[model samples]
Target: MNLFTDIRTLVIASLDAMVADGALPDGLDFANVAVEPPRDAAHGDMATNAAMVLAKPAKQKPRDIAEKLAEKLAMDDRITSAEVAGPGFLNLRLAPGIWQDVIGSVLAAGTDFGRSDVGQGKKVNVEYVSANPTGPLHVGHTRGAVFGDALASLLDFAGFNVTREYYINDGGAQVDVLARSVYLRYLEAHGQEVAFEDGTYPGDYLIAVGEDLKTRVGDAYVGQPESVWLEKIRDYATEAMMDLIRADLASLGVVMDKFYSEKSLYGTGRIEAALDSLESKGLIYEGVLEPPKGKKPEDWEPREQTLFKSTEHGDDVDRPVKKSDGAWTYFAPDIAYHYDKVTRGYDLLIDIFGADHGGYVKRMKAAVSALSDGTVPLDIKLTQLVKLFKNGEPFKMSKRAGTFVTLRDVVDQVGPDVTRFVMLTRKNDAPLDFDFDKVLEQSKDNPVFYVQYANARVCSALRKATEVGLDVSDAATAAADLSLITDPAQLSVAKKLAEWPRLIEIAARTNEPHRVAFYLYELASDLHGLYHLGKDNADLRFIDEGNSAATQAKMALARAVSVVISAGLGILGVTPVEEMR
Candidate 1:
């Protein structure tokens, strides 16, 4: 059903025919031969670089090869013309019937139109939004959460066995701080005035947790020593904070398949086992790291430490597994966690991290490479900062979060669909400006609104047709005489729909879900363009008065557009609107 792929297959077949007819040499490796949309639409509908890529290997001039290839391709019923453009590129114009059939194909496939099997059922682990389980998730974590969740969906649509995961940072010292902070709140709940010191959390969200702790254990652990209450409170606070985070993610429609606790790696021999695996490969050593690049000699302290030869696996330098104090370093648990994932038999691993963790990428990759013995590949994507603007000024911090806006703050302002779509309007590594006033504006400039409006408009058309007693069911529309949909504007939309399958494959291969949002915007534009054209020309309208056959033909195209939009938004974790308010 992929028009582009079908056309490419024809192009390859024609090249093979040329080799047989002695128009070109054999063994010309068509791996690099690509059939894609031409740079200028005025040139043709599609372009191929087969002649240009095979010229040197075929021992023939590119223009000569293109002329013969064009003749061979012209014999096919699908291609209307194949003209040789500048030097070697062969620009192709498909038959109008082919574009019309694309609409029928979309109706036949429904939301499954663009789903691909490029991933081939490979097991993929996508770990994202692994924020510290100390408080509700903030804005930075929101972007990572949305990105990771959408990526998992995209991979699933592309036929990967995806596992959405969250790695809890509960085992770190940060949890100890959270416990002490909750202890202060617990004292306040016991009618004792407490001061939140600089190192402790002061958010009002913890007030409820403190009151809940009092309800669970009345007068127990009251005025107790740190030794008696710290451990118990740490576990309780971590669970409460994780509950808050889970609710926050639910508001935005992000659900993880697994929540991995970093604490599980400790006291479990998992860290030692991971390191032992590395040691067996001669990657572990006892060595002193060189002084940091900018550190002065007098300020530097040299000590023998247990290190991983990360440099051998693409890291900038060797990394320490244990500190001078003989305790595991911060990276030790991360190594163990990834090693655990590697042993889980996943074929691919993807980590979505905040932009600040860019420096951690190489070392983590090196760890996975060493642990998997270069078998499993790791892809790390960093989501950049989100700047919020309201009333044409910088948005204020959330009082509930104390230092930043929470994910719930954004989701509450605009519902989950708008929040999810607007967040992905920009590339992951590029900084995004989330303007409260702009994204909700019902205008073309707002991408989420534009795309949603297109689907809504299609729904309106379908409803009007049904009211007029025209059968617009999927089966009926798909069975319409699509050849009657020959208007230029209608064909334009069909052409864009043809790109969906190809675009999904490209976005999945590059691990970029933002491309799906971008493609949806373009498709929406084409749908809108066709809608506008119907105003002046009654023949171009989706519902032709008194002509059921013509109305069904055009309504089929409109319905097909909605199908693709729903599929694209589904991958983005956004619900398509039947009607935009």
Candidate 2:
């Protein structure tokens, strides 16, 4: 069903044929040869760099290779014309029946049309939105959550065994602050006034947790000092906040496969084990790092510390694992965590971090590389911040969170589907401006609405066809005489549909789900363009009034578009609206 792959297979076979005939060298490497859509659609259906890539290796000119390869491809029934374009690129025009076959395949495959096996069932762990359990998830976490969830889905669609995870930062000083903050709320629930200091969380979202704690142990911990109740309340507060976080993620249609606790790495030999793994390889040592790279030496002081030789693995400099005071640095627990992931036998590890953690990527990768002995690869994707606007003005803070907009604020406002789509409109590494007013508009400018409207419009056409007593089942539509769909506009949509399987492999390989959003937008644009053209040209209409057979053929194309749209939106965690409100 992957037309591009099929054609590429043919192109490779042609190159091998040349090798066998001694027309080209015997030992030629064709790994880099690729058959993809031509940059200019007017050129041909596909363009291959086979001739150019094999030219220097085969000791043959590119044009000579392409001209020879073109004749070989021309013998295939699928290729209508294999022309030598430019120097060595072979532009291939596929037979029209191939495009028609793509539509029938889409209708037959339903939402599974573009599913791929590029991942080969490799085990992968995607860790994201590891926000501290201090409050509700904020705007930044919202973007990470959507991006991570969609990425997990994309990897799954591409045949990766994916585990969605969240790392809790409950072992840090932040959770102690959370415990103190909740104590104030607990006092307030007991009819005593309380004030939130600079270090405490002042959000009103914890009021319920406070009241519930009061109901559980009424006045028991009221008179206790910090030592007596700190540990107990810290556990209680972290668990409560995690529950709140789970609710927020559920509202956004996100659910993690596992929740890892950073505290578990403490009071245990896990940190030592992770370090020992590196030390055994001569990668860990005690040393004083050079002072700040660009700073004056007079302003810097060097202290001997236990450090990991991260520079050997690709980091810019060696990183500290334990400080001079014999206390583990923040990087130690992270190292232990990744070591655990490696020992668990995952083939790949992916961490989705906020843009603010950009500097941490190199060290994390080096740690994993050392721990896994270069057997497992790690990819860290940093999701940039989201700037929210309302009616063209910058969005304000949330009262519930008391400082930033919470995930609930967005899910409650736009609903989960629109919020997820808008979050993915931009690449995860690029800053996104989410205008509440703009995303909700029923216009082409709003990708969320535009894509949904195309699906709903297709449903309307199907319903109207059904009212005329015409069979609109998928089987009937797929079995229609698709050759009747000869219009350039109708065929343009089929061409886009044919690109689905190819797009899946590319997007999955890049780990960029934004490409799915972009493709869906383009497909929607093509569908909408054809629908509008029908207004001026009667032949372009989806449902011909006089002939049921013609209408069915066109409906096959429309339904095929919807099938792919639904699949793309589903991969994006979006629900296609059946009818526009």
* Clashing pairs counted in every model: 0, 0
Candidate 2 lDDT at 458 equals: 99
Residue lDDT tens for model 1, 156-200: 999999999999999999999999999998989999999988699
lDDT of 2 by residue, 212-303 (tens): 98999998888689997889899999999999999999999999999999999999999999999999999999899988777567866789
Runs of candidate 1 with Cα error greater than 4 angstroms are: 295-298
Question: Model 2 has how many clashing residue pairs?
Answer: 0
Candidate 2 overall lDDT versus native: 0.93
Clashing pairs in 2: none
RMSD of each: 1.2, 1.2
**Which regions in candidate 2 have their CA more than 4 angstroms from the true location?**
296-300
